[model samples]
Target: MIDDFLDGSLPAVEEAVRKAAAAEIMPRWRQLATHEIVEKSGPHDLVTVADRLAEAHLTVSLTALLPGSVVVGEESVHADPAVYAALRGDAPVWIVDPVDGTRQFVRGEPGFCTLVALAVRGEVLASWTFAPALDEMAVAVRGRGARLNGTAIRAGSPARGAVLKVAMSHPDYTTPEEKAALLCLDTEGVEARPCGSAGLEYLAVARGALDAVAFSWEYAWDHAAGLLLVEEAGGAHATLAGVPFRVTGANVLPFTAARDQATATRIRTLLTAP
Candidate 1:
């Protein structure tokens, strides 16, 4: 069923993503009231009405699109962590981060997006990243190439001898050990900055505008869509153990996704250096 849908119903999924953003997100952009936004873990971690409503909207619409499918949404997991177990269940799972950059969204910045990935068991089969305010939608299917607004895209290898530009997880979000691993990117020939939105940073890597991304956290909703996009665009990703990242957790921290395998290996090496 999933294979047949991936072959022909991809656009249906795309439309579902776009509809969520249009109906629930864009309307609240820069117009949020004080009561509409609230903190989850801390001030830096926020959840707005837009996020909750959008995820709810997607949950209903997506499950309706693919009967028997389940959703592992950020807001839903926050409400009930047990909902996250769906990722490992037999049912097809929709991993969703309804608002990827809630902090940016609350601040009226246009750097946020909606991320959705279709995963069966542990493998991501298709994904969508929709940045409504920016008017960009990126789609990726397992065996097919990636696309941005209907045009094929690729993550071309970075130039030799050129400095590697990397977006890394912010220090506040990392443990001391993970922070130490990410700090390895500070060496010569690599420019590292705090990441904005995990999805957009992955999109940057996929489109070749950014060299790579080294993220300490491993939330499937945050990395699932982008990782698939990067992979379909001819890029590669690796955890500290130098293996492909797993959506089901227990991954070596501070994973790197790069334009190509060599870059991913180099980043992994740096992350593991003493």
Candidate 2:
């Protein structure tokens, strides 16, 4: 299926994502009226008309490009949580987060992006992360490596013997144990701060801007594309339990992605340490 995707539908998928972003997302950036934005669960959790329209557009175009494929979009799942069940099904599934960082997007921030990943059962095979505001696009194929814009790039190595810089989940969103573990990064000679979008954090790790990212949530739409990007760029992501992350959303909390396996393991150890 991955081979088929790379050979036949990759371009179409990219086009669908770009089209949805340009048509529904970029146009509304920071231009949304008060009524167009609303809270999902709280003040921090947001949804916008752009997110809905983009997901709707991608769902139709993507499903058409791959006849039997199903879509598990963020907005769609918010409307019907059952839509996520497709990720566990036998068919190829398109996990879409039309506007990945809704809060950032609402604030006219550049960290928000459009995230799309193709997964079978529970494993992601290919992924795309498009930060329309930043005019950056990253693509990753299962074994073909990853690309930024159109050029191949490798994840940079961490500086030798320097304090690792990390972006961690905000304390407000983490459990008490998770928060304590996250603070351990500081004691371990790591610089830790709050992360914005999970997608952009992964991009930073892949590009070597930041040493690592520790995230508590495991939503497929948030982590799927970025996980592939990091892995293909010679980076690695794993749960604190020392296992690979699954897009099926059944992983332990506070997973870490870093420039390499060793850095990832080290960050994970710090975050999970007692």
Q: List per-prediction Cα lDDT, in the order shown.
A: 0.95, 0.89
lDDT (tens digit, per residue) of candidate 2 on 131-247? 998989999998999999988878878988988989888887778988887778877578899999889989989988889999888889999999999999999989978899888
The residue-by-residue lDDT of candidate 1 on 64-88, one tens digit each, is 9899999999999999999988989
Supply the global lDDT for candidate 2: 0.89
Displacement of the residue 88 alpha carbon in candidate 1, Å: 0.7
lDDT, model 1, position 4? 86
Clashes of each: 0, 0
Residue pairs in candidate 1 whose N, alpha carbon or C atoms collide under 3 angstroms: none
How large is the C-alpha RMSD of every model relative to the true structure? 0.7, 1.1
Query: Candidate 2 regions off by >4 Å?
Result: none
Model 2 lowest lDDT segment of ten: 1-10
Model 2: residue 64 alpha-carbon error in angstroms: 0.7
